[model samples]
Target: MNPLVLPLVLPGVYAPQEDTALLAGALSEEPLPPGADVLDVGTGSGALAIEAARRGTRVTAVDVSWRAVCTARMNAWMAGVPVRIRRGNLFAPVRDRSFDLILTNPPYVPAPTGSRPPRGPARAWDAGGDGRFVLDRICREAPTLLRPGGVLLMVHSALSDPGRTIEHLRGSGLKASVTRRHRIDFGPVLRGRREWLRERGLLSDADEKEELVVVRAELPV
Candidate 1:
């Protein structure tokens, strides 16, 4: 089931979009044992966390934004699921704790700027140039957060280079690959930056859509 069908999205918090839905769908297909330990990194509105909880998994969610943390907490409360929500950057709030599953839909939109916005709604999508700012960190850190046989289900834009993510995860000793892909029309954010993206060779002149991918990485048991 989709977890964020009607989540309470605070003004500065990110609402569930395509990436969230994509990640949730992948979570639904994962073989989560009852009461499995799960982590939702960057759980903006607790969508994936709620979904995991619905499947009878114990979920702990973390986000960098306080508003997002609060939004997720409230949404999970409304969903009648028990999710431990914390405010911190990726992996910081859950140090030393490993999980059977980790879900993330982090900021992957490549932006003209080199740094993420310090605050505001833009923080949800304004990733640094090349869009590897948060993605690279997750690739490096998430593997360590996974238990033996644990799986990471992450969704990001093709513009961020899913192949690089796979390689990074594999180098970390996890078996990784793209599990799903979806083509979507450029949203307002991408459309407004079309010219800049084209100049950077990240987008083609004829390309009107962006491809989002779900990269699944699993640790060996």
Candidate 2:
């Protein structure tokens, strides 16, 4: 129940990076209304949902992790706000539903093979080869989940073209662009990500370097 619990040790405990948490908190400064309806996709730690709720918004958050789902709802309760947390990949839980604001920090790690992945399937952090697996799927699905004139806020690693993300949203019939950025040591789990790509001859860079991007996409009516 404590915020300091071991996220790595706990099942479905997605310990977000410091920058991720910071980015979530910063959403209040954006143009979102004080009481807009919000959806937090891939609600790791439910930080974004909690933050938006704290800002007086009604939030419905989702994650593939059962523990995360429960944790998110509980975290919202503990924070003295109401949030509907559900278990589903991408937009399954909220099909046919729309939100005024959508936020996601998806699992961008590239799991080239089924045999690989730190936590395996259902953890919601494993994206298939190229890491674009989840990113691409989410982009394609976001428009339908967003309400008319709604905004889709996303945070993903620069390891996979941030520009491509913007392009995807733009091409998907939405207005999109980069809103923020920062870098992090992708941790030991992704240590072999580039190597896996290299083994397949997809990556040629000898040095490891990447950035994470925060993008804002909107479904303008």
In candidate 1, which residue ranges exceed 4 Å CA deviation? 1-4, 116-118
- Displacement of residue 200 (Cα, Å) in model 1 is 0.4
Candidate 1 structure quality by residue, lDDT tens digits, 108-166? 99988787454578778878999888999999999998999999999999999999999
Segments in model 2 whose C-alpha atoms lie over 4 Å from true places: 1-9, 114-122, 198-206
In angstroms, the error of model 1 at 92 is 0.5
lDDT by residue for model 2 (142-182), tens: 88888889998887776667778888899989999887776
Cα shift from native, residue 173, model 1 (Å): 0.3
Candidate 1 to truth, TM: 0.96
Please report, as a residue range, the 10-residue window in candidate 2 with the lowest summed lDDT.
1-10
